[model samples]
Target: MKFTLLLFPLLALALRSQPRSRTGVTEHVTLNLRPGISLETTNAGAQDWIFQIVGKWSGFQDGHWGLELGDAPTAVYWFFNWDSVASHQEFTRSPEYPATIEKVESLASSFSAPHVPLQPFPPREVFASPVVSWVTFNLTGVANSTATTNWQATANDFLGNLTRVSGYRAHSSGWEVEDSRVFSVLVGWESAESLGAYVISRSFAEGFRRLVSGVAWEHRVLRVAGYVPKL
Candidate 1:
């Protein structure tokens, strides 16, 4: 009875000492941006608008998201990071996104629904890095097996070179389990500037095209340092 009484107080003290803030945390999300749209159109205007916002406003405090563009991605795949929901709320209410309440309502209609929410499949934990340079190429008219092989090969070459350029590098890709037709790649870089330099550089840009040519990948989305998986 005496030992139990002593242990209870220690356990209570430990629990009280735990940190309460959830800031600098990351969350995974799968947003169905334009699920029902036909290939001809998928709210290109809205997509572009959001892309602009993400590029400019995101990564403000070492918090960002990643995108997984399938052959027909609807802008759902993303990872969100923030010190906490409070910062996010502030950002949403900031003059950048909504100068006035009226303007906010007017532009709000553009979203598919719940613009940024937790992903369907929960991640083990948010990556330690605040940013990840990533690109998603939509595969066109290629077999699943072929797409994977092509992606892996491209990853092998690109990751090695990128790592050499910058000491930090990692690459990941996954084919849609539901339909082998879709595939996506996630590449990491220490800084967004490094990614931009490589993307536009003649030497690296053409290599990207050549790598995806066989699989006929379309460069749909290029996102800056966003999110990475912890486990």
Candidate 2:
């Protein structure tokens, strides 16, 4: 009875000493800027307006976000770092968040829903060095839940092959959101040429056929502006 009493206080102390923060992850939003709008102008507006507000918001002591441009004049990407899913969710409820979204949506023709990395998926490993190509895909036609599971398994096998290619920094493939069949895959490369070389090679052809068949996909390659280390 005395030993049990002593152990209980120690356990209570240990639990009290535990940190409150959760593992950090990146929040991504792919924007389709308004038609005929130049990326330069859109980016300039974002820097002036959207970036400014998100910077002042709580839980973003790191900085607001990073921006990138893809192939088209209308394509833009926003990447924000947050301590956890709850932090990001909490930010959305802030008064400034809705107004910020309203201003940003005004610039885009359409935008993909914000996509944060899902749990049970390992936290992302972000390289310190900037990547030359940031490729993103929006995919559909994944029919049923079982098919989705099979696809993810096949993708895991495919990722094993992709990592062998030189200059492949990081790659992750998963659903764009939980409870949705639509999915996304983001890959980083050393350069556009490096990615091009791999795409045309025999190895890529085989994997692409197996994993991508029957899926309708839209993709764009972005020139990453800066790199953010994994938090």
Candidate 3:
């Protein structure tokens, strides 16, 4: 009986190890909550809506955040994996889509809807208080080819160093499909405050500074709004 239990785990691992492919483009949404409104307050109402939507809807994998304090905008981000962008466009035309958009907008002071195309990378799941750091930067005077190299190298450095951090969760780096020179990095942390610690550490500071020295970058550190669906 004991050996059988062990074999079950091995069987499960073998199954997971088999070749598998995931399809879909990820959709990211951000909401800058209205003044005086807090994430805690928005979370309860958002959770209610998520439960309803996920129960009947398809395509949404997860929504996460990279929240910040001070004058920076507060945002909630969602990722959807659909077969094609056309499918997502069709989904927007659905009756439920407008109502869903309205509910989300009602919670924010302003939101972003720019059509920045992104190439999807394998998605990673993150738990805990998931603090995300979003960094978008423009290369300075560097050719596209050179910029691509820098981007890849920086991504490797950041992700490689992240593994040594105590609270690391998941990290994704991607280039803008329309303009490959523009890139974004999203790194997750276990707790809201954990990101701050990592950012101030010598390791992160040295690597980030070396990478962004000649570049103009915008970095936003945010708190993840808890809106996980049980289903």
Per residue, candidate 2 scores C-alpha lDDT tens digits across 1-231 of: 012222322422332343433655445656666676654553576545776676565555332222353455455666666665556556666677667766765667555444445342332342232443343333456677788788778877887887799768777554543224555566767766778888889998998788777766555566665333332
Which tens-of-lDDT digit does each residue in 1-231 have in candidate 1? 012222322422332343433434332233333346422244434544454554455433333443442354444334544444344445554566533323212223232111122221122122333335434445555567666676668756765566555424555444432233545444555555675677777768766766667554534233332433221
lDDT of 3 by residue, 1-231 (tens): 012222322422332342332334444445556666555554556645844664355544444443454454455554433443444454455677656655665566555432223343434454234566767776645667766696668767767788899788877666543244657666767875777788789998888877777777877666665544424
Question: Candidate 1 — worst ten consecutive residues by lDDT sum?
Answer: 112-121
TM-score of 2: 0.68
List the candidates ranked by TM-score, beginning with the highest: 2, 3, 1
> Candidates' lDDT values, in order?
0.42, 0.56, 0.55
What does the lDDT come to for candidate 1? 0.42
Question: What TM value does model 3 have?
Answer: 0.68
TM-score of every model?
Answer: 0.40, 0.68, 0.68
Q: Model 3, which residues run further than 4 Å from truth?
A: 1-23, 65-74, 79-84, 113-122, 127-129, 177-179, 227-231
Tell me the lDDT of model 1 at 2. Answer: 14
Q: Which candidate do you rate higher for lDDT, 2 or 3?
A: 2
lDDT of 3 at 79: 43
